[model samples]
Every structure is written in C-alpha cells, then in structure tokens.
Target: MSHDAIVLCRLDELVEGQALGFDPLGTGKDSVFALRHGGEVRVYRNSCPHLEVRLEYRKDRFLSVDGSQIICYAHGARFLPDSGLCVYGPCLGQSLSALRWHAEADWLVLEAGQLEACAP
Candidate 1:
C-alpha cells in the first residue's frame, strides 16, 4: 500500500460534513472525522486531545447538535466544522490531528501508515 494513496472508504459513503474513522497505517488505533464543508473533503484523527480517545456516540457517526460541529461523546466537547478547532469544551482552541485523504475514481485513497497500523 502506498502512503500517498490508500483506499479507505467510498466517496458515496462519506457525505458532506460527515466523518468516519479508518485504521491508520502503522498502529492498531484508528482515526475518524471527515467534514464535507466549504466545498471540500477534510479528514482528521478521530481523537480528543484532552482525553486522547475517540469521539463519537456511535460507530462511524460523529455529530453535534444539528451537525454543525464535531462533538465528543466522551465529554460533550464541540469543535468547529471548518478548522476542527475546539469551539466549546476542555481543549479550547485545540484541534484534531488531520490526515491527508481523498476519494478518487472509486477508491478512497488514504495513507498506508494509517491502514497498516489499524489493520486487524
């Protein structure tokens, strides 16, 4: 697998502002969150800086009230959509770690390190 582009998910699977987690290429842990905002597809490491844990109420579901911000189910923290900055919560001004990814053709190109790490 190439670190430059490793398929993670389908384009149709990730809608605008919707986020999902995938195994990064080198660890058993996985990151989530993909915001389809500002006419762009942005992804981030699915972890709260404050707690170092995943942020989601359900599998593959990361949303705040009205889907406006990324909320952490662990502590009710909220993050801005565009910048992934912590808008309201313990880690104010902090942001989730982002990863380079995109959907090209029918493949979800992701970093190889991301997948190899999280592969079970």
Candidate 2:
C-alpha cells in the first residue's frame, strides 16, 4: 500500500533547540510536536506519561527555558530532547512516544503509517 508523507515543516524553518506543534492527522487534538536539538530533529506524541496530559503549558511551548530538555509544565517533568527520556518528575524513567519521521530535501515529513498508528 502506498501512503502520503505528512509535511511538518521545512528544515530551515525550525530553529535549533526549539519545537513546533502540529496535528498532522487532523485528529482535532494537538498531539504531536517536533523538537530540533543538537542539530537533529525529533518528533514525539505530546502526551505526558505522568497523567497523559498534554506536555505544553502553552501552545507550541514544549522546551525548557534553556532549551536543554522537553518540559511538562503540568508537573515539571523534564525529558531529554533527543531521546524523550524522562530524567526527572513523577514519571521518572518513562518517555514520550517517539514518532517515525524523516527529513527529505528541506521538508520534515512524518511517516504516514506512523501517523495512522497514533490514531484514536
């Protein structure tokens, strides 16, 4: 079966150590966010394991002030940007669900099958 790539953003559009949120599947729920850190881009489901709450306190605000980690403002959980490993907070040792994605030319595309897997 063939699937279409869900474009998230252009490589030049996203700044390093920052993040952008999107609802690529049009699920009506903003459950995905892409983080660019250490010269790499990583996408993850936005739900926090602690309470399954959305990670950002504000829209598209997923990273900590210093941009060293992904922070769950709901409970102050801190996760490694590259690995999504929760290093601190109530849900220690847990991780955000990483989604499959790739950079093609200058666009970041989320794997269509992976996006379907995240469907409700």
Best by TM-score: 2
> Best candidate, lDDT-wise?
2
Candidate 2 lDDT, 26-111, residue by residue in tens: 88777799978998889999889897888888888999888999999999999999899999999999999999887788888887
How would you encode candidate 1's per-residue C-alpha lDDT over 1-120 as one tens digit per residue? 454566777766767656776654535545555667656677777778887878887776777656678888898789887778998889988997776675678656766555332233
Please give the CA lDDT of all the candidate structures. Answer: 0.70, 0.86
Candidate 1 deviant stretches above 4 angstroms: 1-4, 24-30, 114-120
What local lDDT score does residue 55 receive in model 1, on the 0 to 100 scale?
87
Model 1 sits at a Cα RMSD from the real structure of 3.3
List TM-scores for all candidates, in order: 0.77, 0.90
Candidate 2, lDDT over the whole model: 0.86
Q: Per-residue error at 117 for model 2, in Å?
A: 4.6
Error of 1 at 31 (Å): 2.7
